[model samples]
Target: MNRSIDIFDTTLRDGTQGEKVAFSAEDKLRIARQLDAFGINYIEGGWPGSNPRDMEFFELAADASFEHARIVAFGSTCRAGASPEEDRNLRLLVEAGTSVVCIFGKSWLLHVEKALQITAGQNLEIIRDSVGFLKQHGKEVIYDAEHFFDGYKSDPEYALSTLKAAEEAGADTVVLCDTNGGTLPHEISEIVAEVHKRVDIPVGIHAHNDCELGVANAMAAVRSGCTHVQGTVNGYGERCGNTNLCSLIPNLQLKQDYECIPDEKLEELTALSRFVSELANLNPDIRQPYVGRSAFAHKGGIHVSAVMKNEDTYEHVPPSRVGNSRRVLVSDLSGRSNISYKAEQLGIKLDKYGDNVSEIVQKLKELENKGYQFEAAEASFELLVKRMTGVWEEFFKLEGFRIIVEKNVSGSSRTEATLRIKVNDQAEHCAAEGNGPVHALDKALRKALHKFYPEISNMHLNDYKVRVLNEKDGTGADVRVLIDSAEHGKSWGTVGVSHNIIDASWQALTDSFGYYLAQKQKSIQQKEVI
Candidate 1:
């Protein structure tokens, strides 16, 4: 068997099935170029003849050139009792003009009888004719045996015959799919072993994550001699999701000694994952396996100390290997090493054993114990450290603020905010109204600050999320607010905690403005020196 596994990405096809996941033809084309740039083996454009966007994408991709990844057009086999030459779906696959085509056919006897209302033998004939038609047209056909595992368990003989029909019709590879995503990894290994014994064609695995076993089962298939793997970029698909190629590529190359994607391309995994999620208009799940933001976050004091001495003490692999960096999360649980690490990143030199490090650690612990979380709000954490170090300078000071919520004529609540602040010891008061209190505060604060610092007008508040800490207190619980802020083209997250929602949002909003101004000033100073 070939040691090199082929990575087949169906993000444009299957990934679009995910709820809230939609992509236009241009979006699909942009993603295809990125996948090819990263050296994916096969990029499944979409299922042609199903949607206009997919058909347009296939038409546009006909003239596009890919350096490493082959653009594959996907469709199902000819309909039951229909001739291959007359099947519209099969025709779309060939009209796509791609060198390779993937055609899925009924493997489960239940699906064949109930869904297609056809006899098992008739299903096999369509599989045979579909593969034969594509091959005769000079297209390399990959047969997807959909629901193969469930089919084998129900009727092993009937399932094997479907694959045999495709192989006889010149299909080069037969991909086994856990269509219902209910089979276990051990079951996948057993079924794949059985299939390899019955068919001479190479095997592949396409799995879903309903049981959270997509990656595990795909790995099991590889161990059982399958040479091709199918998945999406960030595990985007229907139900639970598809196998995450961001996690799969590293497992095959770094851990399993299999050459799947190139090393340099593998390093771009983190960026690629973020790009896809960004295009989907969804926030990245920072806890995802290899490419997540919090994948290597350290919170325990002992763990931080051990990691500083030797990263292997806590890390499974060098995070930089996949373009992700280790993060030292400072909280009430952190130690001196955590403080030292964060300070280093901030470009603030602190002696590892100095009083400054000890003081900062103790202060952080005290504040965190009082409900100040710095992990998600590094900007506020930096400001705290600067204050403790006595190097902090205030750009502005809040005199006071007020917000009023009243019913409008339409019975909807309207929020009005008044902000008073002093910059250079000069007082400025501003007022604004919004649909909500937080929005009112955001507008009022920026209005007051923009007078002193016009550059702050470039800052935009992106996302605001709130979590109640003491739910036992019910409506009186303390709330934690996390704000994602963007300036120019860069973005960062900051956090705040308070009993009042307005107070929590105000603190986070202030920290966001503070961070934005500080970064802007640093850039200007750097340019002057340059």
Candidate 2:
């Protein structure tokens, strides 16, 4: 019989140790509910004794009910020369109101001698007493043997003695930690197997990613009879990181035939990964395995062609299995297959047998050579196709535009823009002041077009990026601008390139407005047909 693996997530605890990772009390509570809904066995909330924020999280979590996961309080073993009852850290663990308590004890003699300034015997007593204290309080205890692998390598008898102490003290699980994260996969497999032979209780693994081997080491431990695995989402932790449950879960359930989460909940992997990244205010790693945006994205001409015929030709697994979709990118290297696929995805009609496909490919290459990247600026690509095929209708024509900057003695500056445009043979002119030249220009253009197309108010620019294309030319170098626009819960990107920054911004800005108008028209037309 294949036994299930227990997933203990430390994203709220150890994950926060990573640089730039932080979560509020509400954020931690929200994440705990998400993890429970996704079928995580245990969620390590935070150390209640460490900070007010962690204590606030436990207080908030006490009122919130989890459907599946048990909230765990994490702390270290009692300090040397102190009993568990007198230890403030242990006292906080009980008062945190969590059903499970996890505490780490020193396994390395070097730490025992130098860090704690205690003998090896005293360190063992700390581990034994800490676990026994939590058990006596009617709590399930998970004893973490900090630096177990390093300790085992130096003193095998002493390391095993640490696990024996926790076991004798009634630890529910003894987790072997590669605390320094320097252990190899073979060593992990051998050491865990040796521990499993000596220990009667379930063995666990908590590997770090300092060597980028956290997932590999965890997998090796499982293969050697470890039933519990501890990790953080996206491999988030101090130094490099901890074992990435995002990568390890799918690998375990799909490749190793070991159950980590419910098979049906597996489809939520991608969204969960992205959700956590958003909460942590971190950009999602597009190239991350299993759930990243670029994990199933195809770019090459040959790759797209083959993928069209058979996704299995290029993709390792079906993207749908992980709640991610396959993306076909179009660029200078795009073939007819690339454009045709993109056209379908964007709901654009094209004749596959006609010359439009080849024409668009050539035009894409020419534009890209001029520093227009269509891969990320699909809105601009769509407009290009529509114009090339004579299917695009003009929204407005720009007659002229002017900008003025004024400065005062206090180092403050004011920018104003004036623009004129003709819509359906009617001319409109407007002026506007703004914090920046681009903002002033955008406002002036919108004011001029508002009467003709009031729906333009719904679209707003959210992100703007400028890249210098010809750095060799210095200030005279051509620059490309990419603008991200959002409307009615949807977003799109447009690109422009010119020697002048204002001109480039204008081009991208106009394309952003044009794409929104075109999409709105298409939606209205579709509704009429229906």
Candidate 3:
């Protein structure tokens, strides 16, 4: 029989513990539904007895519908010396109304004595009662052996005794947690294999990323025959965060043949990863593995050429399998093949062997050598391709513009800017004031085009980043400005460079606007055709 692994997502409970990773009750509900839609096996909603946010989240989740995942309430074992029925913590776990309850208890002898202030035997009793009480209440019980690997390393006999206690008490699955996240992969495999040898129950792994081996450790546990994987989407958690399920699930399904999700639903992994980060109001890490912006982005000239011939030459798997696509970056090292490939991606056709393709590649290299980078500014590259393909459209023409800065004696400053432009043979002059020169210039330019392209108002610059190209050049250092613009729900990036900061900002700003206009035009034309 083919092996199957259960994917347990803890983004709601453990992921919220990450620094600056707070989620409202509504945010938790939203994420829970997304996880469910992705066919996760289990969703640990939150600790019911911990806080109002978590308590209310469970109350809401109890009523909400989850198709593929069973909602699970997370908590610890009853307090020392407390009866299982009367312990407020355990009571809340039952009252949380989840069909499943996961409770973690002390495993290490040191933690039993120091953290719980209970005798070793009493700790075992706590484990036994906690799992048994939940099982008796007709709830599927999951027992997490907190600090299991470290405990196993410190006292193998005592750790095995804890697992034995939970298993004997009817715990459904025994989860070994690398609470400190300090165990190496081989150590985890060796220890887990030993526990599986002695215990007769399903095994699970929950790891943290303190040692940066969270995913590696989870995979190691699976390699050791553990059937359950617990992790947070995007690896959000306290300290260094927990295991990244985004990277682990694909590895299991594709390489290890573990079947974590249905083959069709596997592609939703990337969106699910980003959805969690978006709800947390955190900037998604573009370089994250598997589901990141740069995961399949090729910037090297040689790599892009090979990828064009055979995707397997540079990528491990088809990006479509994970809802991501291969990205070719245009830069100083780009060849004619890179230009042709990029043009094809942007819906432009070019001869595979053409003199114009070589000329465009040469021009892009010449510009990049003069401090222009198109890798992060795909909008500008598209515009460049259109120009090279002889299909470039001038949305508007810019006339000379100037800005004036005035400061008062009280140390307050004001910036004013004027812009002149022509749209469809009609000249438009506009002036605006702002808190800074760049802001003033941006407003002035937008005002000049708002009449010609009113939708430009909806396309606001979401982020602006500046990078100095030559700091050692001092006053003559060239600066590059990258602007990320958003209209409706779509976003595009554009770049510009110059010795003057304003000029660089304006160049990027202009490209951002032109990119938006070009996209709008294409969208309208497509609608008309359809």
**Candidates in descending TM-score order:** 2, 3, 1
Worst 10 residues of 1 by lDDT: 347-356
lDDT of 2 by residue, 1-530 (tens): 26799999999999999999999999999999999999999999999999999999999999999989999999999988789889999999999999999999999998999989989999889899999999999999999999999999999999999999999999999999999999999999999989988999999999999888999999999999999999989989999999999999988988889999999999999989988998999989999999987899888999999999998999888998888899888888889888888888876778833888888899999999999998778899889888877778989899999999999999999999999989999999899999998999999989998887899998898899999999999999999999999986588999999999999999999999988888888889999999
Predicted candidate 3 versus true structure: per-residue lDDT over 238-312, tens digit per residue: 899999999999988988777898889989989988888889999899999888999999888899889988999
Pairs of colliding residues, candidate 1: none
Q: Select the stronger candidate by TM-score from 1 and 3.
A: 3
lDDT of 2: 0.93
How big is the positional error of residue 59 in model 3, measured in Å on the Cα after superposition? 1.1
Q: Report lDDT per candidate.
A: 0.90, 0.93, 0.91
Among all windows of 10 consecutive residues in model 3, the one with the lowest summed lDDT is 347-356
**TM-scores for the candidates:** 0.94, 0.97, 0.97
lDDT per residue, candidate 1, 176-237, as tens digits?
Answer: 99988999999999999999999998999999999999999999999999999999999999
Error of 3 at 122 (Å): 1.1
Candidate 1: clashing residue pairs, number: 0
